[model samples]
Target chain A: MARTQGSHSDITGPRIREAALALFARHGYAAVSMRQIAAEVGVQAGALYNYTPDKQSLLFRLMYEHMQDLIAAYADQDQTEDAAEALRQFVGFHIRFHLQRPDEVFIAYMELRNLSSDNFAQIEALRRTYENALEAILRKGQAAGAFDIADTKIATLAVIAMLNGVMTWYRAGGRLSLDEVEQAYWDMVHRSVTA
Target chain B: MARTQGSHSDITGPRIREAALALFARHGYAAVSMRQIAAEVGVQAGALYNYTPDKQSLLFRLMYEHMQDLIAAYADQDQTEDAAEALRQFVGFHIRFHLQRPDEVFIAYMELRNLSSDNFAQIEALRRTYENALEAILRKGQAAGAFDIADTKIATLAVIAMLNGVMTWYRAGGRLSLDEVEQAYWDMVHRSVTA
Candidate 1:
């Protein structure tokens, strides 16, 4: 098939990326072959090379783009003066982001080890940036005397772990609405770090 | 390549299990071939069949045995009547169990999807039994007015998720001792649910 081009015409690129994310999430990164992704995307295996040089590039792009999207979303939020409100926004954003794009979240977390060492380092750096954003929020909260965390590092890890764990169980049609789930998690989180 | 009974007898079974666990945890169940597992165990690929019928059986056994061990350990705890004490024991047991056997813990959680539907169902049922044990404790605490949870199911999931999250980051020679980590987690758990 000829490469299609238009204002929003990177259709094959997105299709390949989406197919890769789903397969990586389901069967893991190392287990999924380029041919499998091509089959899922309804393209010839060789045709995939036009989009990605290799499978590693495909995995790297999926993760890199996902991280960029995550950071972009968080960057859009206002930096509130109120520590509690800022923390709430952080928690709510995290829960909703992971719940909405579970395939990306799963690939980002589960497929890191499959990347080559250099690629792994790049992804790791992006992940740390995301973590640091949360840690910065916790530090601000601590500075304002709104939180009472003993160790900011451990506290940040614990909170992120708890938030990320939601992806394992949250269902699209679950009994709890996203609002209610976010509130419940925020309740635990607030109590976790506040005096 | 004769399978000497004594050469295989002392450690082959456990070795095969350990190698399989690590490979499955690192590469994922579908990604790991029996040949890779045998190489890790220093045996012929066919020799692995002596211990496990197939890859799926190996995966199922690792998870099933881990759950069984978890249930057994918790069963042996002191039958204290105080719900707070029971909760503490549960948290402590989980931290110790997960920290010490992270390979099994990682495989059990990450590789479940690779199991056949029938195998997955069996493993999930075993997991539900463990969850119910925790939920039962929370329900009892709620009944006694010691705990203030609006939703028992959600509360149970939150606590387990936090505990399970430890395996992702916990390192053997980490600064925090197992006891210290357990205490910190219990502090969060107590604050989140207790009145």
Candidate 2:
């Protein structure tokens, strides 16, 4: 079949990434093949090369893009004057962003072992950038006497880990709605750091 | 080379489990093969089958035993009378237990998707049993007015999730000592739910 005239790369790129993310999330990066991914995307095995050079590139692109998206999204949020308010907003934003992309979140966290050393370092840098964003907020709160956290770095990691927990058991139509889920996590997060 | 005559099952069992755990943790369950695992254990692929029926069984047994050991260790802890004391014990116990067995903990949480439906259910039930043990403490705290948690169930998850964070980053010779890590975590955990 000939390539579509309109948005060929645009359409196929996302579909490829979507297929790879789902496949990796389910079968793991090392276990999945380009053939399986191409099949998942309804494309020929050779056709996938147009979008990604190889499977490692696909995995790296997925994780790198996820991290970049997270950092960009966090950066876009309004830096509220009140540290508590900023943290509350962060709590909601993080939970919603991750909840909507369970597959991406899972792959990002679990597939690090599969990343090459260079890719791992790059991903870790991006991750630390995101973590530092939270660390900065905790520092702001601590300076303003809004939070009594002992260690900003540890708090950032702890808070992110706590929020990451939401992805594990939370279902769309579960016992608690997303709003309630965020509220509970926010409360715990807020109190955990605040004096 | 002949097989050693000294307690063959006892000798090979732990080595097989150790090799399997490391392989499964690093490469993930679906990607790691029986041959690779046997190679890691310095045994033939056929000899490896004597200990476990298949790769699926190995994966299931690893996860199953991790959960069992968790439950057993938790049960073995001395019963503290006060809810706050109990929670502190749990925070410390959970963090220390998970940290010491990073490979097991990693496999236990990350490899759930690879388990068969039946095996997944069994693992989930064991995990729930572990979660419920913490939930019970929260309930007791709420009853005794020791904690003012919004939702005991979520609080159980949040606290454990918070403690589980330790395993992700904390190292044996990290910036903070184990005692210091436990103290900081226990403080945050205690205050997160306390009145």
Candidate 3:
């Protein structure tokens, strides 16, 4: 079907991205088509091209923006020398961030292979930067003797894994409040790294 | 292309499945076509139907068999009353199983939603059974006062989540041996749970 002209507006970009995120999360990147995403956004197939050059670019933009957002959010937090506090901030921030932007989180995790090699490397580097931030906190904690961990790198990965796993089963209206989930995860993290 | 006719040989089914598993893992389930799988297995597309009714069934079979194999392996282990030892066994088994069967593990985790509702339920039920095995160990540890967990269900989920995450980054031929990875994971799990 011919896409209506002028349908690509300021709002359409985010709308298309949002629709792509959901579809990618539900059916994965390879299975989802530009037409399906366009339909979901209530636009014509050709109009989607006005927003994204191609499906790959659309997927890349979604993942790239999500990673940038995560890095920004973590950067905005108050700097603290206290490793435990820093970790708590990281944990709390991660849970809240993923919860608030479930679509982006889904896209970032599920559509890595869909991006071109350069795009994949770009997104992966951003991810590593975020991960290294947490690792720095863990290392500091170890130095201060406030926490005991066998391996800081592995521990960082473990904590992030546990937190990211929440997206797999967490629902918006689930019985456990996000606060409770965060607390439970914090407790687990505390136990894992503490002496 | 038309599928070549082959006698209903026992090896043919496994061949088709093995080829499908590799392709699915490399390109993802939705991106892999039945014809590609047939070509990989040296058969025509129609010939694949003799083994599997459709592409979805092929995916389900791989996932289903992986779970079954996991449960069976654990079942063969000698009975042990020590919760920690049993938990260690579970972790070791899981890591080794996934590492050895990367294709199956990839499909099971990555292409779960591709299954029909009925098939999804069956896979989910098998997964719960595996999860229950871990939960039982946690419950025993809690009862013995060896583990300090606020919620066994949450703790079990957290522990499993962290353990399962090893697959995302683990390489089959990496410098770190599977035994070493298992040991590292076991150390983390032990430290996380033990009081």
Candidate 4:
């Protein structure tokens, strides 16, 4: 049986993306080239064009997909109605989601400067949507008298950044178990918001 | 007026580091070249070698100095004996110091991957020293029954990471003034570590 064009692209597209993400994460986006990505994907340079138009598009897509995946994952995991429980779940979810995708997280923060203005705006909007999800949770908690936050927007950013720090130093089989790490962060985050 | 070798180096060394820091922050370490940095500083490419042996040295010096400056600044400002007051001063110092040097802070986090192992080790040690200072404060607070931290090291990192997040969005004429931003973080940090 011959391989269909759909199957051929389905296989190549992900390969191209994986190779691109790794390269851009290892070397900054400005240092990576189309030829290098094609080589990493085991394809001709011209073949990459069949999937994405250029390097900028490739960077945008990686960041865009990362944000989308995060939003989707958060949506899937969150089922709580109580404000405190919701915040706890968000802490665990954010830490585990980000820790597993070190490369994506690295590229997501590091390569934002490389995106074109239009692409930057688009990525920024997607990021804001995700941030809004967290802010809404904080707002709910505030109205319910569970959280004593001065500024929900600042609180959202602080919580995310605090969790994002785990990716920098956390390793498998580290001193603290993942569950323990998550619990410690939840403790801090929970206290920071509540009275 | 005759310029001595000392004066010549004093002027060129700083200029070279400034140009390299901007270029590295803008395009990344792997993407920037000595030729480009020299061009940015209005010097010949070969002239850059006289101040710094190579690109790696240039990158390392920029990071090393940034860390040193941070340590020195922290040492100079922290004069309080009360653990709670000391922690508050740290929160304000970290935010103000980092906010003034956006490019340096960006490169310090972004270009770690590009450093040679030796250079990386030195930078990591310097970083740990800074972290230890914060950890020391937390320890004092814990011993004094002022802070209810599960893990002081983790708490130190979480607080620093949260304060660092301000660099990504805070601006001179933003909705919040600098004092307000510092106060907000100090509030969250103080609450998170204390009962």
Q: Give the winner by DockQ.
A: 2
DockQ (C-alpha based) per candidate is: 0.55, 0.68, 0.62, 0.66
Local lDDT at A164 for model 2: 86
Which regions in candidate 3 have their CA more than 4 angstroms from the true location? A1-8, B1-8, B172-175
Q: Which residue pairs collide, candidate 3? A: B3-B44, B4-B44
| Per-residue error (Å), model 1, residue A91 | 1.2
* lDDT per residue (tens digit) for residues A113-141 in model 4: 88889999988998899889889999999
Over A1-195, each residue of candidate 2 has an lDDT whose tens digit, in order, gives: 334345477788999898999999988887788989888877778888988878889999999999999889988988888888889989999999988888889999999988899999999999988788778889998998889998888888889888888888899998999999999999899889977
Task: List lDDT for all candidates, in order.
Answer: 0.84, 0.88, 0.84, 0.90
Runs of candidate 4 with Cα error greater than 4 angstroms are: A1-8, B1-10
Candidate 1 chain B — worst ten consecutive residues by lDDT sum?
B1-10
Model 2: pairs clashing at backbone N, Cα or C within 3 Å: none
Ranking by lDDT: 4, 2, 3, 1
TM-score of chain B of each: 0.91, 0.93, 0.91, 0.93
Give the per-residue lDDT digits (tens) of candidate 2, residues B163-186. Answer: 888888898988999998888888
Which is the leading candidate under lDDT? 4
